[model samples]
Target: MAIEIENKDQQHPRAKKDGEVVERLLQESANDNNLAEVARLRIRYGGFPGARSMQRNLDIVLERWNLTEEGLFELTRQIHAEGRAYKRNSNGEEQEDWT
Candidate 1:
């Protein structure tokens, strides 16, 4: 079964809403009818290439609510092998090849 749906960018799926138990908390600013959805989006889309959170979906909720760090590390646990990881520099722009 599919979880949260992805936003227009189609980068990753939403996260705030789980299988229907936990509630989402979005930022007041820019937060309106779509705020809950956006919060869900940040959680879901943020943890791409892997599961929802380090342990489970709840963690994603906590991270987003506190703005502490939701599934942030998951993005760097070497989720992918050399062939899958982005071959870019810290700046995110693709690096040049010399060797």
Candidate 2:
């Protein structure tokens, strides 16, 4: 016999707010010049998954560009938001048109 699992229908209350935050962060990061510092701040406080992995990626990116904390929070915020978006879309939630 096969067992079927049902998915929940409730929408997360914070989804729209989170999306808005990510959009704002992306816009801010695009115009900021101190990306290196921003990367450092994200590594320190973004609470992203695989802390070591995020730090490593940040370090690699920093090697080629100068950055600062001025806009790192927004950058990291976008990174995490994108990750969430990918997971949600993959799981069959409404897919956002990133294009």
Candidate 3:
């Protein structure tokens, strides 16, 4: 005899979308040469279930990396641009719009 199990609560569609976004961001972070920024990204979203976790993580990463908030913002901006170029070419818009 065999038993079967199932999840009681399925993830919402928005949660799934959020997970995809996080995965993409992590993938971008993983490719960077900057270890400190990678650590910051992990701390920001690596399944830490705590109150004010993001704030605490930001503080730690900034101090450890000696980076100002603007530096962090710039780092994230570069990371976010890594894979977004494809979106410009294949956004389901009219072909004429791409020319």
Candidate 4:
């Protein structure tokens, strides 16, 4: 006998809630380069089993942002090549990590 699983498209309630937050954060990051980096990190490393909503959010961002996984990785490569990272000053502004 063959069995089929149902509700495969359903997302967990918590995941759905988190996805909304993720979408909002991504939208806010558009005008903030520093925040963009943080958002990218969240998208890249926040994977877990049964995180359907979060994954869907990431897919939407990638499509809407017109960015590919390889492009994102290349951006990271350039940042590392420059030996700098986004830092914040005491005044809460983005600064370069010179050290």
Q: CA lDDT of each candidate?
A: 0.38, 0.43, 0.45, 0.55
- Clash tally for model 3: 0
Q: Which segments of model 4 are wrong by more than 4 Å?
A: 1-21, 29-47, 89-99
lDDT of candidate 4 over 4-65, digit per residue (tens): 86644544445544556576755753323433453454454355546665666666666666
TM-scores, one per candidate = 0.21, 0.27, 0.32, 0.48
Per residue, candidate 3 scores C-alpha lDDT tens digits across 1-99 of 888986354433334443444444444433343433334444444454432334454456456667666676676567556732222337774221111
Q: lDDT of candidate 1 vs native?
A: 0.38
lDDT by residue (15-61, candidate 1, tens digit) is: 22243324433223222222333334444545355434422444544
Give RMSD (Å) of candidate 4 vs. truth.
Answer: 6.8
Clash total of candidate 2: 9
Ranking by TM-score: 4, 3, 2, 1
The TM-score measured for candidate 1 stands at 0.21
Of candidate 4, the 10-residue stretch with the lowest lDDT total is: 29-38
Tell me the spans in candidate 2 whose CA falls farther than 4 Å from its real position: 7-10, 30-99
Better of 2 and 4 by TM-score: 4
Q: lDDT by residue for model 2 over 1-99, one digit each (tens)? A: 999987544443443544444334444533333342334334443544333443444544443344444445556566655663223456678443322
Q: State the local distance difference test value for candidate 2.
A: 0.43
Off by over 4 Å in 3: 1-50, 84-99
Worst 10 residues of 1 by lDDT: 25-34
For residue 62, what is the lDDT in candidate 4? Answer: 61
